[model samples]
Target chain A: MKIKTIPKYTVYLLLVLAASIPLFFDIKMPNKPVDSSAATFKSLMTLEKGDTVLLGTDWTGSTRGESKAELIAILRILMRKEVKFAMWSSADAQSPRCAQDVITEVNAMMKKEGSREYKQWEDWVQAGFYPNSDVAINNVGQDVKKMFSPKRGTDSTGKLRSVMESPVLEKIQKIEDFKLVIDVTASKTSDFHVQFISSHKVPMIFAVTGVMVPETDVYYNSGQIAGFLGGLKGVYDVEVMMDKGLNVPDKDGKIEVASTKVTDQIAGFPGKDNTGSGSKYYPTLHFALALMIVLVVIGNVEMAMARKGAKNS
Target chain B: MNLELYYALSKAAGVVVTVGLFSVLYKENKFYRFCEHLFLGLAAGWAAVGVWTESLHTIWYDRMMGTVDEAGKAQSGGHWIYAALLPVGFMSYMVFSKKHNWMARVPLGIVLGVWSGQQIQAYFDTYGPQVRAGMKPIIGTSGFLVPGADSGINPQVIAANVYWSQAISNFLFMFTLVSVLSYFLFSFEVKNKIILKVNIMGRYLLMIGFGAIFGTTVMMRFTLVIDRMYFIWNEFFYKTLFHGK
Candidate 1:
């Protein structure tokens, strides 16, 4: 008997339906953070209040699933830590706006919690986009203020002012002055950041798309980058790490997160919306993966049967 | 306009564009093409504005003309030399014209020179550390499993010592490195059977590596589609229609 296969449309429809289940059903999945993600969280946790960070927002709205969640997680960490940041885009024209959208969303969430709002140009400011990533990041390594001089942002009163004049950037004399440089990208900006800016020796981290993960492993291995958040799993890792921090003591004084390498006990913002795209998309992704595996098996079995039938005939 | 209302409308439009673009996966049609073209046009337009605002206006225009203070006095002296870049940039457009196309190579040469100069330091910055990391020792400094991992008695000290598990991992990594490199040795002929088997092993390992990468790619694509689904359901319809029920 010939094996009947499902139609392409049916498979597509099934996938769409599987992906939608999480939005309707609140199925809590266990998210064990990876080493890189744990390290990423740890790097952020090391920051103190009033410390400045360079946020290279190089992703557009395209990788919003991964990048948006990564940005939200980073912002949650930064806002909770009360660290100042200056964000700019070097990858896409729309990247700065994309960063702003998430920034606004995260800020609103923080405000709802009765935390003081992250003021623009005070708590954090938009440094705008640069035309060339290599040249821009290179310039950033030399002179952060001069590199940011051309781009100006409006303060609360709607007056046009240089980003250099912004309170977020006022104290930052050079690129190395930043407490850390975090490149949240879906492109080669991470490479550019590593190539030029890493020389400044400001501890750097990255949040990249899935395809960039293998290449990122080399950087992680070399210790050129402190840590990275790669794709959706990485996003979930940060979220989970935020939910239950590394080596935190429970009621019985056991390490809560099971990260043996991390001895320093850090706490996460519990009872908050730490569950983001990773928790939702990762479980739903397994359903899609199952479909793929099943389809592959069916195809193989059918091929084998066809070959056997041919031989017999 | 109300911010919430504006945001909701923007999301609704995005959902329509997403569905329109995704329609092509089933079969090609005018809707998908329209959406595709619209996206390209929007991107080109955005980039045009960005090139001016992000680059030329800030780096070139402002530097050349300098800036006036709020008091309307010249705050900084204008540099006349920056204006010369305009002609070089314009000449690059000559590549479209057959007659003066060679003139485009001037700017091209300049760009290539700068890029080549940069790559020397850039290559070291990128691959220098990776080369060092590849030299992992196959020997463990200590035994299997860190001693105090479970007891929570400061895992950091225990972690400093390389255990058997880590040594085994490093050994496997070395094996993979050698095998993969042997497979890529197209320069020399390998008649040795053991070397040949190792080369085959490399090929299989490469296939597995590719499979993992492909798996990651698939997961990412699925997540992207799921995000669009979430946007349509939660952001646009559920949030607006039912007030985030």
Candidate 2:
């Protein structure tokens, strides 16, 4: 059959093959982490081990691939560094659960690796979900203690206690008390954070979906945020950076993931399983993107040929 | 239930639903419809529960009624004043009643008023820094490139002077900004040739921006598809069915 006349179902089959075939094989894509990813990594790495940060998880299963991968990569770093965090969501109710599942999975992975499992209320606490993004963010910026006071989390003994009492949040009196604000979101909650919280001189970072990259870049360029990770590429960048620390030379004295955006030499958990969904899904994404491009090119070329033939006839 | 059993069942259900939903690619069928309805129902139910548990119960009900320990001892005393918000919240539901439909507007108006007030500050908070950043020096005072820029970032050198590279970048940014603004000149007729050309250029630049966004959107959508494929193949088939972790 002519390429132009190929059935739509056949194209779907081709797409499935393109997406699936690469997954079974070990394919590595040479990557250079973008400036934003570099900057984000630097900011996260520079924080003291016990420093607490606010994690705004506003993504659900809709953008699971990119958002979840981003979360896992960032969480791996935070957990490995022994950084404390209070997690919450204002974008969606489902977001908190999605995040919790990832945290559980990561904690299990940590256990399997013989690393310390991040216990709830000590290493982290769930601040629960707030329905209103704008109002909740404003309240968080205004008084973090008051905003989280009503919320409770199960401690080591399974006793429900105020989130404020958790070691993760014990010292966090205000938004500025946290070292950084990291938002892994599929929605516009990051924008709300900028509106309400950025003015408090708290450094912010975002791991946003692909569609948000261009807009998030505006915030990065304006210095409104410290950095951002955008889409699947962003996840891959973080994973690669996690595997090969920025500006840190390998055995051969070559920087694997080199960036001019950072000055300090931050080390990574090189030998560990820093590779997550990003490393797994990225090659498959490339294959899928290639299929799309090829199909589009063929469709256009066929159209041009048909037009030329008609004109000659 | 055992955790392993729970994960297995969930993965199996997920795979089944995923296949059911995806069957639409072949043709419309009852399976797809069933999955769609199931998804919507689950979402609605989850949202209803989530609204109460994640939001109202903790933020409003608990605060209003206060709390107690396991022994029935009061921890925090009930604040009767908090009950006043319930009326205002219930007023929003009056929209369903024909007799008191206008009452709904009260809460909406208050929300709008508060939102508008926030927007005034938000407008500046969001764009003020951006506006300042947009004001870049087109003149270069340093070398062709900022020193140590290629090797490693030196914040000190960057803070000191605008390099030639930065100057070019800033100039392009300014040009793009002006051209894009010119494209939005719908209030008046553009008779000048330069302005008209700039407007056309702006249109092209906007298209480029839109194209970049569209490309990323496509990539994100593809990533979603890939994730689902991974779930079906690795998570459900390999791990769940075959018991291969």
Candidate 3:
């Protein structure tokens, strides 16, 4: 059977038009912060100054569209709160560079705002990449200090030291000591972290791509994780919550966006807003999705008609 | 127009490459192929540089040769222990040679040994807590069915605590978990009628789970396209190129 082709030039024009139309018109879509995103935002907001969070950066450039935005948003919140963090990668060898690039961008943003610039050896640290994820995670759970001893890197002053010696990691003895474990990933490393680290009673959250949302919901329900931000919608939810703080009792004294879990009751502080990928991407996603749905319907109708004509013949 | 201009040009090249690869959606052609091969070449080049900068130079060479003091660059002595890793790591390259392939086993065996030792404790650490948490109380009097704020009540009153709503939900969860676990019983035939029915139901439930996964995947792809649109319009045109921002 020969497949009918749309004229090649026509197809090119259509794609360019579809991609460019959304840009020409300043399309803005309203977003309601979902429960999972609310949980993630509140978790970050609740962290105290000097508190340390473990960031598992398990994404490479291939997922830059989703994962980069997720990382930047989370880092903005963490930096704003003055929470120190240690980053490590177990997913891919290239992940550490991606994480470093994000940190550099965030630091530049901080500098622009005249806020406290996150220092490499002091405020935040890179624990470097580990080849084996399961072994690395298990080792970290058992004894974080011993597991990371072999990995060494140059400090800001060009002095070679083991990652554990950095000021960010000075007091962190075990996995439970960190305030939260945020896994920003495009892979199953989040599952590995949940199984290994969350079992140690450490608070866990996920910034995952869209496809992983359904499977991740199970972890949220089972209390294996504190909360989740799944795909672009998850990103948008965090952005909204950041812009308009959650649990601010309205004029009627009724709490908006109530939580079923223990940590959801904390009252959110208003103002000091910052928007990232979610806010930027979510509105355009609606247009793209609508186009996809229309295309699907058209293709199905055409297929049905073709089958009917064959039957008649 | 020195280093900064060069940097800007490099970024522009990246943008061009991205557009070239994406052009394949119109129709597969030489432009897409060129962009794809360019990406591969750049990635290989980057990887070579990355290994030296991130791994080999810092971890091995720096430790082996030692370092100098900051003031007037006074030399320091080398640590000879780092030399041992050179031979062990080099053994991994034997994988390329057909006859010497068995030599590659030395490094692989060591990695496997370290990985295997951690698995015993890792299995329990990962799954044990989840299994424990899955067990839920089948009854609650704190307004289970109403889906409102929990009405605080004393734990002492056992009879009053048994809310029909809470019991039903918990019963459902427990039932589903058991049914799903039973579905995996390949050791023996499911002779019992009730068990077989439960197993069949479990299969359907799993399919529902897969459907939800598919939905999420679709949403994610929409998000990626949305982000690209945002970049082209908001960041590139409005903020950077056309608009003064």
Candidate 4:
């Protein structure tokens, strides 16, 4: 076969090789976190201990790359603050399991640090997934008790009871009862959260994949969402802030993460040494992106050459 | 017998799966096809089980059949109202029958009615505040076009309060909003030249917005791939197999 006529398999191998090469070299790319991500980090840092937040985990394993990292970082911050959270999902049936796994992982990390473990049905309860997102959100926004009445589950004591009666949700009366609503989703459910849940004047934050960032930003700019964390970069920013502790000055006394204004309030508080998916994934992302750019350039160059040859002939 | 060995095997499986999936990039081979089928089968299986366990079992069945109370527990019995759901749900399957497709409309109608009732309130709830906030000041006393370092105590507050910057931004926002709205003005011809220009600008701005969104999406996809790579290299190879931690 002619070189140009070589099977598509050759091109695929070449593309795969081009993508994989950067991984071995371990190249680092500079990243400046955007204001949205910075605000998300600062908001989490500013929360007082025991303050309640509503966490809507509406993603499953399909979008684990973006959603998992976002959820993990948010959970870390919430756990660190000793904040109380009520977790729920309206996007998928499997979402609750994903949320539970995240909570368990974060709780395990907290336990290792001699910090308080986030208990189920007490500190945080799974409100369970609803098939109809709009109805569930509307009901919850209007009347927390009535909406959650149909939700039943076993408590820590293994006794069956309504979810609203659980310690995590017993105090929640209205949408405004929770200080913040953080929706970590891979779907358009974040839009629903903003429209229905935030309608009650609740502070909202979004942790969404890259594709959703542009649409999500309209809500952010409109003051409907307090802030947002977008895609992997947002996850990386949170992880960096968590490890270094936001706004804290290094030896140079310069703010490393420029968007955040670090204060003395958390100066001495030590951050957990653990770095999860974000830390590991960030560097690899740079490699993948570099490969993509190279492929784009090559494809364009090839097309241009082909056009030139045809014109000359 | 060793836990470490189990971890190694798991890592190996992950590497195999990753390679198998990536094989499609070269050509659609048996390996790639196998992995693809495996993923589909797994996802479908998971969804099926998940819906039943998390939704049907938890939300439907538990609600329908009242739980049994232990020695010191509450009363338990089945709520017949739940039995009514079966017929309503069964109507959904009528969609497959040409003669009985109208039966499917009953459930659909109920869902639509419930959904429609919420939209009226939801529309205002979603857009009211945004529209109100969009009206911004057009002039400022601050000598600097943008808020300067010496102009105020709280930089953010000064920046926020600056009328000129706010005006410019609001104008841009308002212009875009108007222009985009005008583009959908299909009912009548846009006779005004200015309005025509604004509509054209709106189309360009919309495209730019879409481009930015596409860029973000590309970055997100890269991040996902990077995550898989991290899982293979760090979690599987180093941390798990070598016990690097």
- Candidate 4 local lDDT, residue A203: 79
| All DockQ scores | 0.63, 0.71, 0.38, 0.47
Model 1 C-alpha lDDT per residue in residues A175-226, reported as the tens digit of each score: 8889999999999999998899877889999999888888887788788999
Query: What's the best-to-worst order under TM-score?
Result: 2, 1, 4, 3
Tens digit of per-residue lDDT, candidate 4, span B167-233: 6766787888888888888999889998899889989988988889888988877666665666777
What residue pairs clash in candidate 4, if any at all? Answer: A247-A262
Give the C-alpha miss distance for residue B79 in model 2, angstroms.
1.0
> What is the clash tally of candidate 4?
1
Residue B3, model 4, lDDT: 75
Off by over 4 Å in 3: A1-32, A111-114, A146-166, A252-256, A262-269, B2-4, B56-82, B137-172
Task: Give the lowest summed-lDDT range of ten residues in model 2 chain A.
Answer: A1-10
**Residue A163 miss distance in model 3 (angstroms):** 5.1
In the range A1-313, model 4's lDDT, one tens digit per residue, is 1125345676555544544455555344455667687778767777878788888899987688889889988987888788888888888877998889888888888888888888887788777777788787777788877766666767888877777888767787888888888889998788788668886878788999989988887777777887899888788777766766555567776555444222222331355564666666677666566766876787777778887888798
Instruction: Kindly indicate the candidate among 1 and 2 with the higher DockQ.
Output: 2
Give the least accurate 10-residue stretch of model 3 chain A, judged by summed lDDT.
A260-269
lDDT of 2 by residue, A53-104 (tens): 9999999998999999999989988998899999999998889899999999
**Candidate 1 chain A weakest ten by summed lDDT:** A255-264
Per-residue lDDT tens digits for candidate 1, residues B154-203, read: 56667667888889999999999899989998988999999999999999
Ranking by DockQ: 2, 1, 4, 3
The docking category that best describes candidate 1 is medium
Worst 10 residues of 1 chain B by lDDT: B146-155
Q: How accurate is candidate 3 locally (lDDT)?
A: 0.74
Candidate 2 docks at the CAPRI level of medium
- Which is superior by TM-score, 1 or 4? 1
Model 1 Cα shift for residue A86 (angstroms): 0.9
